[model samples]
Target: MREIDTTRVLCSLAELEVTGGRGFAVGEGDWPLRGFVVKTASGVAAYVNLCPHAGHPLNFRPHRFLTSDGNLILCHSHGALFARDSGLCIAGPCAGQSLTAVAIEVVAGYVLLGADVDVERLANDPL
Candidate 1:
């Protein structure tokens, strides 16, 4: 089995407090895995930046992924709202669909991508 790299750090835990969420990228070359992390009631959560509704990136503005109330994930493209912890689309165009989740963990006050995640494959085929 190939070794999974768990050392990919996304951002510091303190950073999520300022904006509620933040975006990140992993891997190299042309197609890197793009994702975001959000602060949730239980802890922290992360997801692929792609919107299931139109296959567009969820955020147009840097680190801006939440709604005005800071209660949900907002897709800037079509106003789709998603649950922070579950990545479930609760409203808008893709009501029944969901954002692809990227596994993550918090360590030493930093958020890191999960070791089991296949960053390259998930980036290219985020279904």
Candidate 2:
């Protein structure tokens, strides 16, 4: 088996305010894995930007994945509400579905992609 390096720094933990979020991309060229990171009470969580309902990016505005109160993740396309910690759609067209999680880790105050992620594959495929 061959191992592809998908590890990349998404951002510094300090960049995300508590309950706030930020979008990021891995790889380059036409297809890069698009994702976002949210700072939670326990830690940071990351997920693919694609929304399951319409298969569209969750937020039209950069780093605006959270609701006004920052309690849940919001998909602007259809008003899908998701649990920020679990990415589970609590309501909307895609209810019961989830935003694909992008494994991540906090290292030295920077958010880094986990070793298991396949950038090329994830970039080309939507779940």
Candidate 3:
């Protein structure tokens, strides 16, 4: 089995099966790197929790980032719909904008933040 890195683990693959997505945070204090991971058709994708339309966290409820049908990422604040894989805003006020992608990979049945990502930088300058 591959050695697991507990520090970087966001959520288990099994956990995503229930909700289709999961929110996570990295770092500490004032502003940790808040993000979410979603299961995509191709594999999985991660993005900053901040929505481009109103700069609000996409979900109003915990881990509820998908539409009712589990098709796209829904911004609860303003009804923005984004592509699950690419984070592109396909509908709503911010049509041409996209969510800030976070680097992540699944290994040993767990999702982990990519090694090169700077948590502090991302949390501070989410755009």
Candidate 4:
């Protein structure tokens, strides 16, 4: 695995699920920026863990963010399925809605938070 600058690193791209998903957290204190990263054909995509339909964390099990077949993002809370690359909810209570995407970049085989993002603010915002 490649060593990344920890201040911005989320995970090593190699550690991310190739046909599934992996959960991650950034910052500190009560409201760290919780999210997940999914491996996609074009590269990687990430989103806030909060589900749009219920404002709940999408996974009930750790790092279990993708559907069994590994084609979509699954919210274990209520079966909401989202497109892996776009984070758009295609079915379920929040149909036509979308997951809140966290800006991420792949660098030196590491997934990282975009430099311009405010971690504390994004972590605390209810939206």
Clash number for every model?
A: 0, 0, 0, 0
Best by lDDT: 3
TM-score of each: 0.93, 0.90, 0.98, 0.92
Which runs in model 1 stand beyond 4 Å of their true positions? 1-6
In candidate 2, what are the lDDT values of residues 54-100, reduced to their tens digit?
88999988889999999899999999999988999999999999999
lDDT of each: 0.90, 0.88, 0.95, 0.86
> Which candidate, 3 or 4, would have the higher lDDT against the true structure?
3
For residues 1-127, write the lDDT of model 4, one tens digit per residue.
6666679888887787554677888988878999988988799988989998989999988888888888899989899999999999999999999998889888888888888978788788846
Q: Is candidate 1 or candidate 4 better by lDDT?
A: 1
TM match of model 4 to true structure: 0.92
TM for candidate 3 is 0.98
Once model 1 is optimally superposed onto the true structure by TM-score, how far is the C-alpha of residue 11 displaced, in angstroms? 0.6
- Pairs with steric clashes in candidate 3: none
* Lowest summed lDDT window (length 10), candidate 1: 1-10
The deviation in Å at residue 90 for candidate 1 is 0.4
Scored against the true structure, residue 20 in model 1 reaches a CA lDDT of 99
TM-score winner: 3
lDDT of 1 at 95: 98
lDDT of 4 at 109: 80
